[model samples]
Target: MAGRKRNSAEDIVRKLRRADELTAAGKTQEEIAGELEVSAATLYNWRRQYDGMDTDAAKELKELREQNGKLKRLLADAELEKDALREGSEGKILSPADKRRAVDMLVTTMRVSKRLACRAVGLARSTYARTPIAQTPADPDAALRTILRDYARTHPLHGFRRAWAHLRHDQAIAVNKKKVHRLWKEEGLQVRIYHPRKRGGVSSCPQTEADAPNVVWAMDFQFDSTVDGKAVKIASMIDEHTRLSLMNIVERSIPAQRLVEEIGKTFALWGGPPLVLRMDNGPEFISSALQQFCANRVGISYIAPGTPWNNGHIESFNNRLRKECLNRNHWTSLLEARVVIEDFKDDHNHRHRHSSLGYLTPAEYAAPCTHTHQPVDGREID
Candidate 1:
């Protein structure tokens, strides 16, 4: 059996016009249907549907229908794009893994097609379809990561380079520093860096550069309080060349005499006084007692009254003490503060890796210096 032919809007309109002309020419409906080669039912149905419509009107209707369909398709695409963007807005979709996750979310939750999800997330379909390679059981970085995690736990204040130094030197693990840095970031062990505000104006006082151990010693004071609110004063002195913390004196208050005595004790314990003592113009440092003590034993290089940068070595040490020790521990009594502070000073000398010292501890760096003197016993104070 032959199937009936489907006519478009324009063809139907032309056929209907022809049928009307034939009807006006005294032709029967059956003849018109025969002439048009359509069934009587089809011709009747076309007339009923396209009644009172011209060919131009039918063409306009067809155009309108096509335009409407195109608009609907465009709107759907737009909606899919909007949904994909919203899904990826939680954070930056920087990595391929992140984009894959976004595509999966859109496909699963929004019921969108994989193609559309990939397009919306700015990922290629092939990339989205690709599977990630799995890691093997014998990972090279496993041991390094374990060591790094332990180092990070113990020294929360140290950065990746310091950790690398500890691994290479202390642990005898020969790994690249860059590899350590990458693992450090992956393990979330990177320390937050503090950026100091830039200040203008140079100090009038000339700075002294230390070329050898025991050449220049910098001394400074830091203040804190016990839990009961009694004031705790700290006096820190360090060898500028070797970066060794010579002494840290913690007490309720240190007058000129006490300060002079502590300096004398530090000098005797460390095998002698430095040639030059770098300090700020504090009352305890500038008093006649301290001035006379320095005049006989060491020369005083007082920085400009307000410029602490002239004594930057001791200032940096104080900052580390405050950050790593004092800020982390709260002391209920003066004795506890002294004990904890002493332990920190010893750790800094023997264990802390200094970047300027090529990641070596101060004690280790000073050990090779010929001018460095050996310390005597009975150095502990009550």
Candidate 2:
């Protein structure tokens, strides 16, 4: 015998309505059941359950029940995923090895299927299924790591670019800078950076852009103290385009006349005066002595008061000088400070690899420009 078939809620409701109509017409229960193609007990049960329900209400009820079941399934899946992630690890999973470990945890502890575990951990099923190859016993970067460690020890202030330059040029190692940077990171070698509180303001003066080597020169002052707490003021001048430290004078104090004398010496050394001399509105820079000195020879471009960013080239040079020299040394006397600062200035011009100049020293970058200019007399002042 064939099995009994099930009726939908709408169909059952419709059949119950038909049964009521048949009863009103004086048909017996058995006759109504026969007309509905169901047993008498089944017809009674349908009439009791869906007696007052219309077809639309029955259809809506069925839909609501299906939606509820779907929601229950979704909630269960979410809970499972949450438990799986908790069993894995904290924070981001970066490496493939980390991802593999997460997938294994999900499979073993969470009792999740391999496909579901891989999906939850964001790993490819094929990658998770494949067995990992054994690593080679010989270390390829052993020699490079030793070299980098020694370099880092000697030059703590230098970063990976200087290390890479040392390896390529000094040690004659033909290695890519990117690879050096990778090893530098893996070895935990990095310059400790100091972040200062940011100041908010825009420059009131228009910034002068230097296009060529001798187009513009930037000058600034930096101060330090000796062991006796006596003031050691530093005056620095650099070509804005080439980043060459033209002059770095360490003195007890720099009056306007002395500053003008130093400027004359720098001009004589560099061949001629720059098109513009960029400086802040300090008293020395604005004094009649320095003003009379640059009145007819070189143009003066003073940054707005209290705006150091307008004179950015000299500010950047001062920052480097502080980091690489002043902060690293202890001076006992005036002569010692001058000698040490002068040596650092020479090193900065000849040895420091400037990133803006494609890893060339300031002297190397300014070499071709130096050859193009004719020498000027140091005594030609108005």
Candidate 3:
């Protein structure tokens, strides 16, 4: 036989809490009894159960009931949001008609009033009722938008005028070109114009004008071949500010050590190393000897490889040297190569008008720095 039930103080408090929740859910007495595993009489008796519980416990129960009410309202709002929103199609926003239909659905299915449903869905009452005429005609370009997408997919390079021609006569669609043009712009469809490729590697560092002669030096190497098939390697240095050629050394194999020696000679001739040395990542320029040579005397600024434009001063000079000196002559011996190259270098510093220096020769621009003695055809200044 089952013993008679004993309702402890804690059990009474828990039953009373469950009873209030069941009441809010609209459960009948018998349903509450089944869920609580108690007789219907017990639920009626536990109505005054919180009176025996402590004040803190009673306060906590009251807070929980308030929180439950808020949760129910939130759940209801989330369900309506899911039903109200729809993914935009063909790049069009949800139309007024679409929103109005959603509002009507919420009112019917959720049993909410029209005003409340409209507020819940974030739609203004005026906007939901716009275009009140029930017999408004459908969009004339509804089919045109679909046709334009298909046509552009097939002929991507053709513009709106070409597509309009095809539809007017080729397929006998009988649509006005004006309507097609309007739809084309509204749909954001167009022919893709091609852009040309940019040349050279882009400069990566911030740069400023070289304010004084020998303040910055641009170094690079050029290669050519003698008539007997022996290779010629020439290293050249130009003043970044003045565009003056500081040194031009020609050798069969230009090593890092040899290049460093040439640079040291420039320091001796020009008083000291320049503030910044701009060069490419060529082995000779980036080697340990060159790195230490510039350590205290000059800062090395390495340009991004494949971007000759970064060291544009030397690059422009090398181009001219190649065109005016290398390509113009056939070298038979290294002695002739050195002598002829020296003469060409002198002529450039003395006569070649640099566009960047206001069409002034590199020699004239550099004259302010070399105040010692006379300049011999711009070659013996430094």
Candidate 4:
């Protein structure tokens, strides 16, 4: 009915840049022409026109514009937060949903990017990034999702496997398990997350004696990014015996050498390296630098890959840290991330109660005095 859509002016400009890049990469003229849907002669002309000039200047300029937009949004969000804090100081709690609605209004009316909209409203980018559930006409699988949800509501115990079987048997439909499973997961019908554990294998054996402090330290890496998309690599080491957070190291990138340096610092602080350092088989943990660093000083015990529960202490800490500190807050700079994360670590150590330690905070559990560690006058602080 319609001919192929003609290349727009902006599209032609983009293709010219791409043509130059393809030419530089030693690709044939015909290849670039076909990929860009232009004649080879056109590509040749584009090269003659753009080769001598800095074609990337256009792209860089566009990127700079985008960066400037984001920075403006950051400023707006900062102002919103300032006002919010002033309101909070007057005993008025800020309503997040109201703020989110205002961002949505701006996004709809102004056609602004969701990232910018969220930043302008002082909302976490992660919240804006969440996939919204809506009953809509454009959704092809709306009826199916509704039916599956109704089925799940009726039978709470049934997983996607059973859901698939029920659909085929009761509705007389032909469908595969994979499609059903994907829909089930995306619809949030799957309630429980079951982790598989090796039953009786020797390698699956759980350690028994983390009885005293400085016996075993669990290590893991928590990754995040600054608002401008700079990587924030956080290396966390926690004493398994005492549930004490040993160190939380934040950097742009943490290689094996960096990991070793953090471990060495912790070792010096804690009197010496623990007998065992429990870790996952991550690249940095298994590298030669880390292996050599741990040699004769601390025993390296790598958990089976995919089983994070083997380092359960640190994994648990990651959940709390990411939820309470990382996800909710914006780290505009590396220093802010470092400072805020360290503060969260301090709060976790001194205030947060651990069920493993009889509901005592890590600081109290690790304390030397039994009387102070125990509830005073048989009354718990909580």
Best by TM-score: 1
Model 2 C-alpha lDDT per residue in residues 128-168, reported as the tens digit of each score: 87665422336688889889999899778889999998887
Clash number for candidate 3 = 1
RMSD of 1: 7.7
The order by descending TM-score is 1, 2, 4, 3
What digit string (tens of lDDT, one per residue) describes model 4 on residues 224-282? Answer: 99999888999998988778899989999888897788789888997988777888889
By summed lDDT, the worst window of 10 consecutive residues in model 1 runs over 373-382
Residue 232 in model 2: lDDT: 98
Every model's TM-score: 0.73, 0.62, 0.44, 0.45
Off by over 4 Å in 1: 1-139, 370-382
Give the least accurate 10-residue stretch of model 2, judged by summed lDDT: 373-382
List clashing residue pairs in candidate 4.
none
Clashing pairs in 2: none
Model 3, residue 88: C-alpha shift (Å): 59
Judging by lDDT against the true structure, name the best candidate: 1
lDDT of 3 by residue, 234-256 (tens): 88888887787889898999888
